[model samples]
Target: MILTRFKKGDLFVAVVTATLLLAAGAAALIARAGAGDPVAIVIVDGAAVDIINLRDARAEERVYASALGTCAVAFEPGRVRIAAADCPDQVCVHTGWISRPGQSAVCVPGRVAVVVRGDRAEVDAIVG
Candidate 1:
């Protein structure tokens, strides 16, 4: 029996192809596992107000608290937005819905923060 040997270039290409396939498979698994789910919105005043089992949310819904003031978080298919706010700057309201994991909107004056929580934790920082 005769055995065929792979050249250096052929071996390199095979290795690269295997690595790519593995990476693709891993990414697909991650995406499937991290699929979207219903998230609760916690409005913190002097006391914590929990809005549970919220499936669909609208941009028109305005959230308010005595301590945190007023702010609105809009919900889309895969995201949430800050539609309005009682704060002077209104920056938080402008931030809009953050669908990705680890995304947040904060209104200091209103003492309000909206964050998207997901199953997989995201890295704190990304370096290019």
Candidate 2:
């Protein structure tokens, strides 16, 4: 019975669904295109400190930053991580490495943060 009624309403519904799916796919592609590439951004005390190009960084680098005390940032290839921190919890240091957009390690006590972003880059965690 239901299969027999697919002449008008069902066709409209199917067309609408296909259109919606196509629109969604196109929107996703546009967003990805606008995002460009992932970059490492370091923020300290609500300020950006460094913008690093992980793609261009062949040699591993250790970045030392001092805010409340001290923290070490390291990166290689396409990933960034917090190597160590003098803060009490050391949570930031345990975040390991991040390579994808939106991945981040934040130390509230030290006011330090490291994040991988899809566009642009910034640095942070420098007191002086």
Clashes of each: 2, 10
Q: Local error of candidate 1 at 120, Å?
A: 1.8
Cα lDDT tens digits, model 2, 1-128, are 97876688789999999999999999988877745567788898778888886776565656556557577888888888888888899999888988877788888788888888765334332234
Point out where model 1 deviates above 4 Å: 1-40, 46-48, 51-62, 124-128
Residues 2-120, candidate 1: write the lDDT tens digits.
Answer: 22665788889889999999999999888867345545454555344644323455434556654647776666555676788888998887786676556667777887776665444
Candidate 2: residue 40 Cα off by (Å): 0.5
Candidate 2 matches the true fold with a TM-score of: 0.62
The C-alpha TM-scores of every prediction are 0.54, 0.62
